[model samples]
Target chain A: MHPAGSLIIFTVLSGLGFGLLAFLGAGVVLPLGWEAFVWFAAGYALAGGGLLASVFHLGHPERALLAFTQWRTSWLSREAVLAVAALGMMAPYAAGSVFFAQPLPVFGAIAAVLCLATVIATSMIYATIRAVPRWHHWTTPAVFLAAALAGGALLAGQLRLAGGLFAVLAVALALHWQAGDRRWRDAESTPGSATGLGRIGRVRLFERPHTGANYITREMVHVVGRRHSAKLRLIALVGGAVLPAMLLALMPASLLAAGAALGLHLVGILAARWLFFAEAEHVVGLYYGRAAA
Target chain B: MTDLPETTDKKLGLVIDLDICVGCHACVTSCKEWNSQGYGAPLADADAYGPAPEGAFLNRVHSFEVTSEDGPPQLVHFPRSCLHCEDAPCVTVCPTGASHKRAEDGIVLVEESMCIGCGLCAWACPYGAREMDPAEQVMKKCTLCVDRIYNENLPPEDREPSCVRACPTGARHFGDLGDASSAVSQLVAARDGFDLMPEQGTKPVNKYLPPRERDRATAAPALEPVGEAGGFLGWLDRALSRL
Candidate 1:
């Protein structure tokens, strides 16, 4: 709820990384009967590498295996289970595709579904918490889906033969930008409403109980300036969406150009994720006198 | 291990009289003294008798002056700590079963050694009762002086918590709420006692009795002064009063 940059980056980055891997694995493993397995392998391996990098960000990565135990109640646990399942399906698919000269359709389809579900689960984990007003909205799921779609498109582009999927990526990027805009506006409106006071009323911080910054302030009341936020939004929209769309349309269907576009998109996604955290206000922000407008 | 039940047919809880509480913070000091020495880890204070002292105190009395349309300035002294809820969210959220509520007497407690400092229990509570001991990296909260209460060495009458004993105005009361005929239960039934943040759905067991209303019949109207000049005694009396 405090919108920690580390956590936001972890979520968005990992979503892209894992989503791409899953998509690549699905393409190669599933019986699309694609000409070359090398491209699929390369994309899947790259995405998997990103996924591995993201795990280091967790506070208790050692306890992640225990995450599966609470699947009955916690979506986090379900996500962990599905993540392992997807990876497991991919392992055999990768082996069969490269070495055995055959791809497993059933396993690939299951892995693809599981990967999508995992992303949804990850999104819901943050969105479900009632304490965070900005995240506890319908737009959260859409953001998650868009991130995955964009990541999948990047991976598809890396494979280049499946360049047509870039259209899907372009659409997803547009949707993400629109959703981000709406969420920013909604947050601005709602933050002002958090104090349970009207626009005309003036509230001042005459006294505070604690002299030193407490956990509440450190964890909940992170504020970002309007100018920087707007700039970041612009960067994300252009770099993540518009440019990628152009590259997908105009460029020779070469893996090198597609890779560049994907890299640029990832950079844009980083900016977007940063803004998502920096702009989104927590309900607890009211206590610190940071209610919206 | 079969041990004797701490309270035989008793579910002891607190009944706080809002009218009598002056918010002196004596109860908080007594609780810290009793609990830290007997049951749990010390309520460690940093920089005591120096520049800044920061520590965990088991009980805290907050002073707030509320002004209502129908009444004069109402000073509400809210003493908050752990409510020891019936549906304790802390226990349910504990991943390692470190926190639990007793089925015998309904006392919620934590096994400090077992706590991994995950901070989930703290999030579950709305009262801000649970605080993490930074030194040990474990969650700590009020134990209701469990060690002092059940000790056989102390007399039967001294078995109650230190906060209840140290209350100057007799604002604090502790007894079995489970027994219908008990004094605390009877007092709760007689007066309209309410729980703090009932909408939180924690179902806290501790009850606060509302401040009693005063009768208007005992009040007298002030007389209007006749002139600006007054006698020497009256003038001296007014000056002394101001001084």
Candidate 2:
């Protein structure tokens, strides 16, 4: 829950990139020749660059290929496999569109579904972690997919679709925050229970094992200032959802407006994603005497 | 390979007694010392001699104050490490199949060679059991001294986890918990040893023995006047009374 910059960039950029690819594959918009080339390049860059950024988060980036091996049980593995599959499948469709001006409907449709599946797999990596109660909810995936769809629509210049998806994203984000706020308490993993001292009495941490921070404390016990988080939440909502939705609704045909909306939305999503990791209260923090607020 | 075995032949784990552990951190230091040289990777420290030193440690002792209506607050030294759960979320979350549970002894371990160090396994653990090594950038956890536990090179008495061997108070017990007749299982049954965060449903193999209740009654006995104070005490008592 340290809110590593690499992961924040990876999720936000990849989500948007995949979202755009999904729309493109669905035949939502068809650009030909040089126009198609620009569109495909942007999509691949966002998606590929995001994937590349995620590799930086790994301690052994060279061994990342092995990550795709355990798809049977690991969501992270599934995510890696799905991402490669989505990117590989989209290649031919992108080539055809740029060269022959053919949309390649069949490949586009399959690639679109794979693109969405890849995003879902990415979300599932966090959603399945029961240790972080805030993330272990249906709303996690809901918010992720909503963000992807809305951001994708905005990038594709599909104002009507973007407007609708933005509304859904807003609802999903609200629901995710509302539920996440209560999840730690709902999980009932208090310091007493964590130490198994609740049976006798109330337990309070008296002394930490070490004087300095360790890996667990650095990774899992990140404490965000309440006021800071509140402001970020406002930025996420206003910039990510409200402003962009308003822009799309008011200036439905303005390419400049769409570009501005996309920019604001990315900033908003970045803030939201930061909050997503920073606000997460891992159960491990109970050992360090940091109560989930 | 990340999938857990249907059943492990043995559930080897630790049973730490909160009643006896004094938070000495002997086990903590010994664990780090033994594991650094014994197993996969040396426990790495960043800025060890500098300010803001951070390191990876497999075992740590946390001191907690427990207060009850019947008695004043008491300090409990709790040692935490990998529980080696029957359903370890850490193993299943490993992206590279580096994290795996032993079918033979039920010791969950990371195969360092395959570790990508993405840290999903650490996130899945609720107990803060796994720490990413600063130097190696790979996950480090309690191996239960796997090398020593089965090592023919060591004497029979030393064939246990370094933590268990280092504990001065004998609070740490390591054995096969799967066998109900094992000393650890019997101790758990007798002392009402319970899992940490049972709600998480990891079904942890490691168990903790709750601290025994403290005597709340005053230690000093009430003073009673003898029929007459004797000798110097009597004279002093009479003198004080007169004053």
Task: Note each model's CA RMSD in angstroms.
Answer: 7.9, 3.3
Residue A286 in model 2: shift from native, Å? 0.6
State candidate 1's TM-score: 0.68
Instruction: Compute the interface RMSD for each candidate structure.
Output: 7.9, 0.7
What is the Å distance of residue B198 in model 2 from its true position?
0.6
Q: TM-score per model for chain B alone? A: 0.84, 0.89
Query: TM-scores for all candidates?
Result: 0.68, 0.95
Candidate 1: list runs displaced more than 4 Å.
Answer: A28-68, A158-211, A220-293, B1-17, B27-61, B85-114, B146-154, B157-166, B173-186, B213-243
What overall lDDT goes with each candidate model? 0.62, 0.91
Tell me the spans in candidate 2 whose CA falls farther than 4 Å from its real position. B218-243
Q: Indicate which candidate wins on lDDT.
A: 2
Can you write out model 1's per-residue Cα lDDT over B1-243, one digit (the tens) per residue? 011123334566798987788878889889878766677677666565667545656666655443444445455566767888776756665545567778778888877756655565665554557766645556778787787688799998788888998999999988878888988888888877777655445667778776676433445787886665579977997899899
Superposed by TM-score, candidate 2 places the C-alpha of residue A237 at a distance from the truth, in angstroms, of: 0.8
